[model samples]
Target: MNGLHLIAELHDCKCAPRLLRSVDALRELCLTICAAPGLTPVGQVFHQFGSAKAPAGATGAVILAESHLAVHTWPELNAVTLDLYVCNFSQDNSVAARSACARLIDAFIPERVEQREIVRGSCPK
Candidate 1:
């Protein structure tokens, strides 16, 4: 399944209050963004690390029919990293992947973003 993979590092992000702290909020955002790209989400799992006294951050992955999307947020540093990958097994999903990635970046509102796109799996000869 040839695909496109998008990776991004966001610095000085000004995300919504719930986005950085609440697992529910982040899950919703993932689902919403996935839908925007017409990706079918099979399931998802998110975990919040650290103690109640001093909350750390959240990390999660959304399993898609095409591939998957993963994200991690560092509230203390106001930073985030995201991964969105979609396979072209059935159709070309590169555009959808880019659309989803763009929406996520917009939500984060990062002052500086380091991003990259990689083509995964070679085309059939």
Candidate 2:
């Protein structure tokens, strides 16, 4: 199956602190982002690293029909990592994947970003 994998490292985020440290906030934002790009989310999972009294970063994954989206945050470092992969079996999903990835990057409002697009499983030019 031909697929696209989007990876990004975000640094010095300027977004709301809750988005970086709150589990619920991150989960909601992720799910919403997926849908806007016409990506079908089949299932999801999220976790908070620290306690409510002293909240830390969160991690989550949204399982999609085409593939999945994984996100990890580090409030202490003001950083985030995002990975989204979508396989094009019956139809091409590359456009949607890129859209979703860009939206997520924007949401974080990172001052500096390192991003890459990898075509997997023998892609055509």
Candidate 3:
């Protein structure tokens, strides 16, 4: 195993107050992360919830050759929660995971964050 998975919870994102309420931005972010180095995207699915209602949010998932990346947004609270998971079948894909995570984080520009990087299927027990 030689893969990496990163989980991040972004709080108080400025753009979440304006842009992330729509599913388009969420889908775009997922695609961008999928295109990161050393990763291959096989498919993707995104759903927009309450877009025309009193409150709004977006949920998206990108299927990759290695594994998947997912994101959920709560625009009313100005927050976004993300998960990036990649598996290494032929070679290590840790660096690519990190690079992609950074790009997503930069897009949100959160005022506070809770982040973790985990070795997925890469730890030998």
Instruction: Give the Cα error of residue 9 in candidate 3, in Å.
Output: 0.3
Query: Weakest 10 consecutive residues, lDDT, candidate 2?
Result: 116-125
Residue by residue across 49-119, what tens digits does model 1's lDDT show? 77656657888899999999999999888888999999998789999999999999999899999999999
Off by over 4 Å in 3: 16-18, 53-55, 122-125
Prediction 2 TM-score vs. true: 0.97
Q: In TM-score terms, which candidate is top?
A: 2
Q: Per-residue CA lDDT of candidate 2, range 1-125, in tens? A: 78999999999999999999999999999999999989999999999999998889999999999999999999998999999999998789999999999999999999999999999998655
Error of 3 at 35 (Å): 0.9
- Local accuracy of candidate 3 as per-residue lDDT tens digits, 1-125: 56788999999997645457778777876786668576788899988888466438888898988788999988878899999988777767778888888888888999999999887554544
Please name the candidate that would achieve the greatest lDDT relative to the true structure. 2
lDDT of each: 0.89, 0.96, 0.82
- Residue 56 deviation, candidate 2, in Å? 0.6
Tell me the deviation in Å of residue 65 in model 2.
0.3
Ranking by TM-score: 2, 1, 3
Whole-model lDDT, model 3: 0.82
Candidate 2 stretches with Cα past 4 Å from truth are 123-125
